[model samples]
Target chain A: MSTAFDAAEFRKALGAFATGVTIITTKAADGSLIGLTANSFNSVSLNPPLVLWSLAETAASLPVFRAAEHWAVHVLASDQEELSGRFARRGIDKFAGLDIETGVGGVPLLKGCTARFECKNAFQYEGGDHIIFVGQVLNFSRSESAPLVFHGGKYAHATRREAPDAKPRSAALSGSFNEGFLGYLLGRSHFQFFGQIRAQLADQSLSDDDFYLLSTLTLRPLISTSELDAGLAAVLRQPSASRLPALAERGLVAQLAMTAESDVAEYRLTEAGRDTALRLISAAKAVELEILERMGAEDGAILKSLLKRFLGVVDPDASVLWDDPTQVAGKIPGSGWDS
Target chain B: MSTAFDAAEFRKALGAFATGVTIITTKAADGSLIGLTANSFNSVSLNPPLVLWSLAETAASLPVFRAAEHWAVHVLASDQEELSGRFARRGIDKFAGLDIETGVGGVPLLKGCTARFECKNAFQYEGGDHIIFVGQVLNFSRSESAPLVFHGGKYAHATRREAPDAKPRSAALSGSFNEGFLGYLLGRSHFQFFGQIRAQLADQSLSDDDFYLLSTLTLRPLISTSELDAGLAAVLRQPSASRLPALAERGLVAQLAMTAESDVAEYRLTEAGRDTALRLISAAKAVELEILERMGAEDGAILKSLLKRFLGVVDPDASVLWDDPTQVAGKIPGSGWDS
Candidate 1:
């Protein structure tokens, strides 16, 4: 279903969209071979050069990435798209059959990466589907190689400067992430909204599931009876008993259709629902921006893609109940690839 | 003269290096627009949301950049390379005929740039021949179109993501400047060394003369004494009184005869010279990497090319020279195109 979440297709599409490529490798505590990849990594630092990248939380190499005492990121050569792809996919060993040498602490050094920076892990932030690992660079390497690029959603080798005598780029990618937000507008990707924000929102009383429900009603209002039945994801397990009428009495949601004529009826949001949705979207937008700010453009793009991809994978399709003749992949029944 | 610094030849050869295009404009205190070209833009912060770019200290608009309370940067698209070239050139009233809008703090924002962000000056570092200006993004704008890119020393347009369900590229060209460097090493092109690592090494202490030396060295070092002599900038005469013998006395360099019959000698770095040269190379290499790290591949390449072009204009062939090329364009007696 949905192409089985073909990692390659995802990467190629991701590359086609273009993201920055950073060689993220971790140094073993004993300083042995560092597993390096031109992962589109980013920074989340102020007091230090904290940076991050998303790894398949379930990758076998996660052990290496986790056990390492230090991690080094080498911005790949613009000509090294092949290298970035190699590291991105699931492989037995990333360092296999490549021309590499030893770096400080015997960390494997990519031969042609534009820049190599070794960092110490600051912290890891877990959200809906992916874990964001932050690292701070301590030592690094720099080269004359152009960075390998991930653009257009695939591994794309970057173009060279047209004229050596060109001018500087403008402030195209500039913005910040809202670390203090308590919610996010979850995308179709498995990424959940409000997990991080609410964690930081400082309200211990509100559960994530509750926040999730609040967010959903606020974002996609006027959910028809069937749409709600298909997309609700059992947020509160339907109360297993009949609480719909009880909640309806409370004015949380009101049925628009007098009767379910064709197995579907409209359930419109109340004024309170609209207000809550407005508040949630704003907070999530702020947090989305904060995430962008935390992750530089290139890395941020990767962050968005990776996190959002998970969303597209695990989340229910909005078209679940629609009579789709073309067969929308996401709208299919029970087709999500979530673990 | 060797084709190495044959200005025109070098321009064409290095032109083989590609980059993204950008038009940098600022609003003078008088509300007039001051514009220039640069490829040395980079992202520096995310928390406070910051971007950084470099300007040759000797540009005509240096004062405008230095004195302005705020400035706007327009990341040019591929079709805008002409704009990129025009702004980087000296003496031209860059904004005379251009259409632009004022944003955030009335900063001049050029039309057609894929993205734009306004910033309050955050930090400025004097790196070699340029001033690295760090700005905190106060406001920004985004467009739905693909960004114009500079690469292989030329302008490149983006191919939109393939249809159906792909998300449009939200990030513009910013961090992919080292393609030329990768090309140089990969033998895809030559004379791209500077396009790959120009202002990246600005933070390094290497002088423009040293950079010129490095550039020449990167292209098969100047092994001949005459070539070495020709490499030293003749335009800037050292005060006779300051012509001390420390260079010779330090024994850091030596002039060796090419052959017994010919008086032609080769200028070669001595052990100390080699150490110094390696040190400089390493430092500049770091700068190159930092450029990749901060700007990401596409933006980095564009920024490098833009800034390098500025360097070529301001200093001609001298690495440490920061004078706007326009000042001496007429005064320097080589190509009558000097004007």
Candidate 2:
């Protein structure tokens, strides 16, 4: 059967079954620590507490595992990718310079895993080029951290899928936007997010555009009109000239002395503006904390990472708004902006 | 060793190791199809292409599987959750009204899965209360579809995590906005998204606020001032009274006849406004397609779903902007808004 099958294709097919990463560890008879990363670990029985993992017959740790009375499986967490890679290497002291705990039969246990299963080696079966070791679980512990996933020869993240019943709402009328629209989602999210901070803005009698201007002012001590326009280009459709005068009149911003670099003139957030911006920002951060709490930390991280990537592709030059205002002059040429 | 361990606790610990869902199927001696969802499936060896899965000894299909000479494992795709659940249940015809393909030894193979392995049952081991059956794979195939993940007793979606080296850029100065900020991410994403369609707005001689007004008109035939204000409140900070007259002067919007129900008149898109908006929307959709293409389809869906969830938490009332204007009056009270 093996002679007829393509080994590479077989391996590729096996990779399709995504598995949580695990570092199986044990102690050699000579008292040396031994471990290797494997995704083949799986639970076999609950009543008798059995779990199993297989190791290549030619592996250096195979002899150690075969002679060991016990071994432990550390289910890697999303943050343990480096540890997974460390144990996967050859001819290296995987446990050197690390904290470890001795489990059943002195098997070294790695910390910060999603789960730790300490087991006594119970049975070994010949599995072609590998040996399958079934273990009787003696003790175990689990954590709430998200598990690290491996699929198609790459690390992945698993997000709790929304319930099937939570379907994307369709628009009542045709040609109207629905929840599925990326633009609608982005716009609505922005507005709703700002909506949380809007109370603070209202207290300060600042509008959405005013909030935008005020926040931009917080990015630097004194930003020239040209710099402000360029930085806020993607956000504000109306020019800063229209909103700045009002903020200045309200004493939220103050004009800076003309500089030798240019006569464009610059504006800085006044003391009151700084205090208001800080207060509003703290409130906004609180809103973010609540929203992220509801969305789960893992999903929230993935969402932000993806949004940054999307922004990278769509608005590569948009980051200039937050970049050092002085460096903006040199970055303008390759900023990928047509203007 | 098992006597002291709680079965439920052990099972909970094992659940921490996420596994892709699989439906194992085999033909009974009577030629009847037998299938059940299992997450115990794992690759055992590469040389002989061996894979293994454990079945509870008490399972009704245990005898059938024990006697089977061949079986198939179907690694499910993310979209196959319902099929997974259907096969997980007992006392029902799991194969009812479905297309099925026969594999080795006349074993039934499920369709639309991430991968499939047809194998010859080669070995069985005593695994406490379960039987671990090892198979020598004779044939297998795989698809690029994202695998269905099972973790902590629920189905999940796996998204390719960005490499750890790709960290978010930190702010140049402390206490300033960077990619880590949700408001910055959302604002940048929205602006950059609209930036793609800004050219169309420019071609139509429309300002950003004009584009917003024109697009809002596309939602309904007749939008009242109050409805428009409420709907676009998070978006447009200025009163609709200021923007409406300007739009009407430009013939992009028109004041409808005042109704007996309310003194406030309604407005709708003019023919030119509708045409411009439709054209701009088509352009925006193209940008969306390009963006989604760059980001894999699965991640794109997950990101949008998460953003929608986040919006649901922060601004539950924001959806009214897209709701039918006629229905707005009745929904205002419970719209999760103070006004």
Q: Which candidate ranks first by lDDT, i.e. highest?
A: 2
- In candidate 2, residue A107 scores what lDDT? 88
True contacts kept of each: 0.02, 0.69
Worst 10-residue lDDT window, candidate 2 chain B: B330-339
* Model 1 regions lying over 4 Å from their true place: A1-29, A32-82, A85-98, A103-107, A112-147, A152-339, B1-19, B158-339
Local accuracy of candidate 2 as per-residue lDDT tens digits, A1-339: 122358887887898898999999999988999999999999998777889999999997888898899999999999899999999998889999889988878889999999998899999999999999999888888888999999999999887777776533434445555566788789888877877788888887877778778777887677878878887787775788888888889888988877688688679999998887777777788888898887678878878877876776676655465664455555545333211
Residue A163's C-alpha lDDT in candidate 2?
A: 74
Candidate 1 residue-wise lDDT at B191 = 14
Q: What DockQ does each candidate score versus the true complex, computed on alpha carbons?
A: 0.02, 0.47
Stretches > 4 Å off in candidate 2: A1-6, A90-93, A96-99, A167-173, A205-227, A241-280, A316-339, B1-5, B91-102, B167-172, B205-223, B245-261, B264-280, B316-339
TM-score quality measure for candidate 1: 0.35
> What class would a CAPRI assessor give candidate 2's docking?
acceptable
* lDDT for model 2: 0.82
Return the lDDT, model 2, position A143.
84
